[model samples]
Target: MGTTSDQTAQHEGSKAAMGGLIVCPVDLDRPGLRVLDSGTGDGYWLQDLLGTYPRLVDGTLVGTDVTAAKFPKHGAPQPISLQIQSITQPWPSEWKHSFDLVHQRLVLGACGSFPHATAVRNLAELVKPGGWIQLIEPDQTCGIQDGPAMRDFIKLVTWVFERMGGHARYAYDVKRWLLDAGVVDVEERSVPNYLGARVPDADLARRTARWTADAMMPLLKYTEGHDGPIPIPREDLQTLVPRLHEELLERGGFYPLRVIYGRVPLAKE
Candidate 1:
């Protein structure tokens, strides 16, 4: 009972999605770049990056999410363009090997089961010779551990996502896929989510509770397609929120977030 593509796009992995955006600010410095992207919900990364480096006016960009989004706000010598597309489908044949960079970030189940190899192959095929491709995913191990809220939160979400037949653990070993795809000069970086990081970050914790509720709703109602036992109740979602809130504040508070990414030139020099 997860959200439709529209609603689910909002919370790309907490830190995993954000980490994908952490691509080298250096990529923006190169001239005349063309970037093909995957499932960019808000397009904040491109909006902020083009603004960060006005010289990138010579660059071109296109983004694809399952659904459309308002064009991002940016200031640059050239306008940034976005394209919305389905993750499960084949490439739009005309655009093969066309982009200077291909990036898929925190798409989890959307990238396909072998997200590591399959997604990497997709990105590699889109990049022009000498161009590059990058993949960013999280290994939520850092964010998980034995604890009250932490343990409960993990169990609930994992159970819900896994049951849905979707990826709840794209974080682990995403780069291995990149390497297998023959990407060269590959590199990786890991960063923490800083849960409830500061006052501003507290909202992250709240939102997660909301998702847990949404994830569970589908599981409970869909079993046996109208004949199975009610595994969970609507009230259960409400009950967890307050409990999750309190757990985030306890000492040694949860920090369940980490991102790893890899990048490589599309062609050998």
Candidate 2:
């Protein structure tokens, strides 16, 4: 049991179907595939799907992350026979309706547009008739309508997200965007982050540690990357970690997350 960064989201078995470790075979066993991986962090899953997937090595996989250089730093070496492509545009026009599967994850919006839903519409257009689109996302500052952390856990980052025209509340309502984009038979599944998942798995425990460290590192020093304002001070956020950890440990944070997806079942030309 070893830990890998961003390998299948830090959700332990939360992303059981997409997470790293190859605990199970990730083969989609479908035909005529042209996959577009949005937000492909360090190429973890893509590498896994190609090398160990046992079912998709022959299909074409186009990988994209927030940036072209977001490839993962470590993994059990990937396959030699997979197609990889970089995407930097808000959306790709040339690849419309050309894929059997379209995927996006952990995206930050740029402009006021609903990238969450816009991406869905774009991916929908990219999928050949009867294809599928999958999206996964988690918000670090998850809050309920009246939760203790909604506005005061550390500080207000809501304005920060708005400053850059991004959606701070995207996670809770993202699936709405997918449905409006003509994606029928939508299915939404929620996977919360439980400190319990780490209770016995040394690997997951380690990953949890790193994630906590990274979040508390006052990552605000790099606020320039976010746009403006550090939102809550790094010191403030760091201070909350111990309490947050303790609370989650008491019953695992079960942070709300959404994995919403849909299928285009009608055949298209």
Candidate 3:
């Protein structure tokens, strides 16, 4: 449901919300640094990392997704490898423990069919000893404000996620998942995400609103066509997007997020 421009806007918004491209304090200039981005939609995260640190041009950067449909039509940015991969399945044997950093964001929807903890464990296996594993996820359970329509939207989305077998509010438990995976020095950073007038920047607010609306459209349509206990009825679902946007613009909203990271323990340190 997200266009390229919409994806770009959301990517920039996440960067602004998190305050930087790389958040784990890992050295980007290190020679031969190896990095992996799971569920790399359009390879945006990998592209931004290389663009931010030109010295990493020689470093090995790879982005993987379950499919290549969203990858750049021409090719991934120079020196970045895009592959077809599913985080729930076994990765290439050669890739085991090969990356200095493993990163993923907003992919809980993709992990809906399986336990997210298992996916996290799979991602952790790719990190080299002493390397970092970082995950950024949207928090749907708290900080939301204004708009009964928006509240219904959240409820419908949460129902969809739960029906698909993933918890919509799984971000709160990610630190324990990392700890169980044997990752050390775990850190969780919370960031305030404002939509509509809640954000000081008007342009960003509008773009974020559009992104939200676009994302909700497909889900709304799905619920309308499918048989489920959707919070919004089919007739109301038809007008929900416009109402949600109006509420966001008039009253503003907050959707907090989490940036969690930790280092895999070094071998026999």
Candidate 4:
């Protein structure tokens, strides 16, 4: 249960890891561009997008999540329409084929409860013909440059993911899912998301460490309650924060995130 600010910081690290706010080749300068960020925890991505491409102010920018409690309700530099929408469920009929871009990230938990392919199809249907859909998900099966502690942590994560009914490496099949949903020209890119030590930017690394801890602590609680097989001793779960600090501060590791995007086919003339 990461707080809104913590989630926002995690997304900032994600953006930095990906190298920018956008990875697709879509032109933001296009007039009347309508963008949708599904599972927008706090609308930070929408805010960043508007800041990066000021012209979008004239267009529609919408952010949707299952809840709106975290949405920026005041002092937003740009206008953003926030909605309570679940990507795993049906969307409003009026939204079909309406957006120039549909973006979703870190919805692996939702995927646990719903068919991921169905979710992909739902997102694909929202895109205008020739528009794009982008998905960013962590490759939880393993980490990049993982030290002993990180490797053990990944095992715990994989265990939790399986318990939730989702594949630990679900990201690897996203391209196929998009293709099955009739999207074309699909492309996938990956980058290492650093959480601690070794990051050239000290402040960002520290922020990422806090974000990671916040995001995982709740899961660790769940693990602590369960009486099943686990990667580490059940009692040791209480000391996760300090262990994470040492792992991140001493030998730093990174998780890999995959960015996948594809375009909807235009209607035949």
**Candidate 1 local accuracy as lDDT?**
0.53
Among residues 3 or more apart in sequence or in different chains, the pairs in candidate 4 whose N, CA or C atoms overlap within 3 Å are: none
Model 2: per-residue Cα lDDT over 157-221, one tens digit each? 45545655565667666567767777766777665544323335656644554454345334343
Candidate 1 minimal-lDDT segment of 10 residues: 1-10
Model 1 lDDT per residue over 1-269, tens place: 12233233224334343554545433667787777667665555455556666755677767677765444444222456666676666778877767776766656555434334565577667767666666655444434443465555555555555556555675555556666766666666655444332214444544544443344344344343534333344455445555554554442234343333344453444
Candidate 3 residues 1-269, lDDT tens each?
Answer: 13347546677778888888778978888888999998887788888899888887989999999999988788876789899999778899998888999999888666878888888888888999989989999888545355787787788778888878887889988999999999999999888777776877787778777777667887876675677566667777888788878877777777778889999998896
RMSD in angstroms, candidate 4? 2.3
Q: How far off is residue 166 in model 2, in Å?
A: 3.4
- State the local distance difference test value for candidate 2: 0.53
> Whole-model Cα lDDT per candidate?
0.53, 0.53, 0.82, 0.81
TM-score, candidate 1, is: 0.69
Worst 10 residues of 4 by lDDT: 1-10
Name model 2 segments beyond 4 Å from true. Answer: 1-13, 17-27, 72-90, 108-115, 139-159, 195-199, 216-219, 222-252, 265-269
lDDT of 3: 0.82
Clashing pairs in 1: 1-218, 138-171, 139-171, 143-256
Top candidate when judged by TM-score against the true structure: 3
Using lDDT, rank the candidates from best to worst. 3, 4, 1, 2
